[model samples]
Target: MNMSEWLVRTARRVPDAPALLSGENVAASYSEFAANAARIGGLLRTRHKVEPGDRVAIFMKNSTAYLELLYGVWFAGAVAVPINAKLHPREAAFIVEDSGSKVLFVSGAEELHSLLASTCTVHDIEAEPTFAAEGAAIAAPEPRAPDDLAWLFYTSGTTGKPKGVMLTNANLHAMTYAYFVDVDDVLAEDAAVYAAPLSHGAGLYNFMHVLRGSRHVVPLSGGFDAVELSALVPRLGNVTMFAAPTMISRWLTTARETGYSGEGLRTIVYGGGPMYQADIEAAVAHFGPRFVQIYGQGECPMTITSLSRSDIIDRAHPRWRERLASVGPAQSCVSVRVVDADGAEQPPSEIGEIVVSGAPVMKGYWNNPDATAQSIKDGWLWTGDIGTLDEDGYLTLRDRSKDVIISGGTNIYPREVEEALLMHPAVSEVSVIGRPNAQWGEEVVAVIVASTDRPPNPEELDAHCRSLIAGFKRPRAYFFETALPKNNYGKVLKTELRKNVSGL
Candidate 1:
């Protein structure tokens, strides 16, 4: 069945139930949402001439209208391409052009409309009329095939230009099923608060509220605001939410200052980057055992590995606690393996690149056969992330293959070095990158953010690293900065770091 049918089913089953609530405004119920989606779908078809499989870009912040547009595009038998609102016009236009989106939706942002108007048809979402009067005129399209493209997500291209990953209706349905299996306890009564950008996979997957007929709440300002989140916990009682590691760090600080207990919160799913054990422990303590750790990518839509509440609760044993550091066991629908460069599977405890085979994996990169060929081989999506699987079947992510630092033929994972630096009392955040060296080929370099009023010297930090990790893995150079640059999802932009420190 087509994934868009979920909205129709939910609307028919629970027409009066709350479908979407954006801040103080409520979209009423599933029937209302479906009607609005149909109306918008009709408008796109009749006025905008949105054809089947045509790419319609949503370049707006998180809102009730954004969700409507997503379903509307799919209902109209077109593909929805949600671009990052934080991206500059040039970057947004690149995505629009790359996806070949014929029409773009813009809400509350005039600059974005101005940017896309030059390349494609631009529509202001606020100006659109409600479906209440357009019922008789609006016509629903024919059923969509499971293999029809539902969405196009752009991944950060190692080369200069980003590539769009084409996800089919079947891919999304598979992802929703796998996600529900991983977190079966989340039900219709639960509400999910979206703290991440709606453009990213984490945000889009988390917003799959149709499966369980749950309520979706987007922040008022359409950005992560700690103060607003603290208030939202009480307003939307017993809600589940997801955030990036950096957002969690900020929330931890805010929760401490405001004495926010997150008492009504059922689950706090975190992914996009590795959260430090200390941070996870702190979050678990404050929010109870509802901290679920998920590890996946845009290609997979977040169903690879999951660490549930039980895993975090069983942290008494040092070994068990160490398992919390892992990304956890593979989910129900996915088959994960660690393979060498030659695509040979590695034995237990041996580090190699992590590869996954699953229904949720994207069909391929849109219009890029070379990249599609490089990523998907023999039906397995090569993640490019290096990891190891224990005899117990738990998978531990070591580092990304490109991020690995090879110094004098010894492979050094930056996560190991960064973890040691995080243990330092003076260190608040840290990132490790490899630098070119004349003798060792590539030398390790550590960049750190010291605690307020406590600056750490390079020799002292280097000594700490040496004490914790092997000498060869220790960073030879150290740079102290007030803050480290990170992407929208809280992942440290290592590419930016490499460019910044290439001279060093």
Candidate 2:
């Protein structure tokens, strides 16, 4: 089924229901949203000559217009390539050129014209006469096979240059279904805030909310600002949003200081990075049981293992702490396994590479057959993350295989040490890596961002680690920095850190 059909079906059921919001103002009702999308789709076909399977890119910040163009691309049976608005001009152009997007829908980011110069035709979505032109009635929803491409998601490119992940209509449908059963329960009155980058997970979640005929709200700030989010949440009742862990930490600190109780927040689905156990525990204490964590990659747009809201608040359970540390069990509609080097499944509690096979898995890396082959073997996508599945089926992520620290032939997962250090009051953000050592092959090095202006003593940090984890796992050395280098999505750029260490 064409994924756009969800909007059509929901509009027919609740024509007058609110569908889009700008802060508290109603941007469009379900019927109006559908009509706008159809009109935009008509413009894409008649004006831009966009055909089935053609690629159309949108390089704009979070706004109602961005969402309209996205659904319109899908409605027109073309693939939507939503580039991160914060990406370097060169980086953004790479995605546009790589995806072969014929027309780029831009919204006043004058930077984009110079960025995508001579690459693709740029259409100012706001100024497009066809976008505002009326009398373009709702046309028949384009027919697309389940396997046809729906979205071309570009990876954040920490490891190398970005690769386009080809998410199919079937993959998105599965994600929408998973959100309902495994993520959260959404009602027609429930609204979702697009506080994170709409180009990434936050935008992908539009499917889940729209499928339920819920409202899609873009904050006045256009992006996340804890103060703005704090004020907006209470005004928009029963609101849910997808945020990165860093964004949540900021909200937690802001709430505590300003005494903002986060009223009317239904759920915050956090992913993109590990939410330290200490951080999540504090969040639960302040927010009161309203966070869901999902662990997935670009290859699988956000349907892998999910740590539900129930798992966050059930602290009285004997295994609650252990479960909280885990990313949770395999989400509904996917088969997760921990496989050894030879592609054999590992026994319970044995750490191995996590692999997933499901409908939500991508078709392949766009135009990169070698990468596609390396990632997907048979039907499973070999996620580079190493993890273990307990007897009860909970998966505890050890670390990304590339980030493992090997000291004296012993493998030490960086997450283990990072979590231990995060427990220290002085430590705020830490990234543990292996530095080259002649004798041990690699020595554990902890790069930290202290909570205060005064850097925490290295000995004190090491002493704290000794109390929480094994002695061998303690950092042999520590480096203090004002902040850790991170990508636009807030994931630490460990590759850049490695380069810094190499120079040292």
Candidate 3:
């Protein structure tokens, strides 16, 4: 059950099927892709001495080569450890050392030679001699069991040091199946563009497309560029791309300037961070019924609830707005619940910690049993997200548990405050955080990115929030910036924001 087995199957079914693309041009066919993977797999076993359970890390950005190396490692029956390309060299090195990777593949080996003191062999994927030179292709991929570790994904260390989440072959198989049954369907004619970071959810989504022999597009920049996608999508018709909320916002801005109607764009599976109501509504109005929202974490690797295209565009339903704001019901394979601090199930409409138990949930954090036990209690992965579930089973996210502000003992979720601020005509993007106050404990403060040169004053935003939310929920202070600090996946760095606010 090595994940690369899917690539082999696609190659046999559609030898001539288009596989990888760079911009508008075809980079490899299905047969060619499989062949290259086999050869690379052979090289790993023969030359690099990678064993079945060994970890091989890929630290490169989005490219056809990245995918090739990823599958090649799996084909060799080794676990693929993908590092975020946006991380600092030191940070990437920590993951390499912690994962105990046998080899570290990178876009540039020279930069990491000094930073990484580990004995792991480093190879530049572009300059690897065996990628082009003579190498025996593996006749068949090494066998793997269902519980065998296929990927070791490290959580983004926004809170503390990253812990590797071990994802097994069975977990991935369930996630891929859930995509078709709950998420959007993929066609052989569809093209999946890698605009979001491949080390995250966007890369993990390659399974469904590969199973159907769909085309994969790696942007030349190896990252997001709305202008590039605006042109590329039309060139490659029937395109589907995973995006973060921030990327979607940038696309909306670019569409306004370029008048691009999202022609040839089939579906956008957006996740990785909280997508506010105002932003999602605006996207649907412009792009029509082409957006799907998924809510999951590194522990699950994108198999949670899915907000369907129909649910997103359904304006006629009596509860459409409320449903639209939700992440939809639990996906086919998982059981979701909202529970109180004492682990008791909360009634409908009561906010609590969201927990999930399913085939897709990670077995545990790699080499961190204590952390794993703390996170997954009684078989349910305690997703540190604060949310409420309605009677119909739709889950509405409030905010992260850490992001909740206890002002005068009244809990105020930042997402609620941000959503209210975004309702204002002048506000483009906003993040609300708690500023420590001596009297009231923690007071609400907003960090805003304005749409126009004339930013909304604190009084204007205060009045707008009052109409939409409770009096105490409105921000007591406002800080306007050109943009909010975000991670590679476009999640607002509230931890970083809080550090700055601590100074204020």
Q: How high is each candidate's TM-score?
A: 0.79, 0.80, 0.81
Local accuracy of candidate 1 as per-residue lDDT tens digits, 1-504: 545577888888988888788864576588888888787788778777878889999888788777877888877889999887765555677788878898888765565565554458877656753532453324554477888898899766455366798888888888777777785466787777877777875456643577678888787877678889888867777688777766777787888999997866888777776566777888778767877888888788777888777887785766886688888899888899999999999999999999999888899999999999999999999998999999877899887665766554334568767877889999998888988764445789988888868688888887876655556667888887888999899988888888888797
Q: Give candidates' CA RMSD values in order.
A: 11.0, 10.9, 11.0
> What are the lDDT scores of the predictions, listed in order?
0.77, 0.84, 0.86
Best by TM-score: 3
In candidate 3 the C-alpha lDDT for residue 255 amounts to 93
Model 3: per-residue lDDT, tens digit, 63-179? 888888889898899999998776656668888999999988988747667878779988886675446344588898899999999999986422436689999999999999999
- Ordering by TM-score: 3, 2, 1
Residue 22 Cα positional deviation in candidate 1, in Å, after optimal superposition? 2.0
Error of 3 at 240 (Å): 0.6
**lDDT by residue (tens digit), candidate 2, 1-504:** 777899999999999999898988998999988888888788778867889999999888899888878888888899999987765455677788889998898777676577665557788866763553553644867999999999999873334366899999999999989998999988888899999888989999998788889999999889888898888889888999998776787788889999987698999998876667988898989888899999988798788999989988887889999999999999998999999998999999998999999989999999989989989999999998899999888999887765766554344668767877988988899998888764345678889999988888988887887765557778888998898999999999998888888546
State the local distance difference test value for candidate 1. Answer: 0.77
**Candidate with the larger TM-score of 1 and 3:** 3
Give the TM-score comparing model 2 with the true structure, all chains together. 0.80
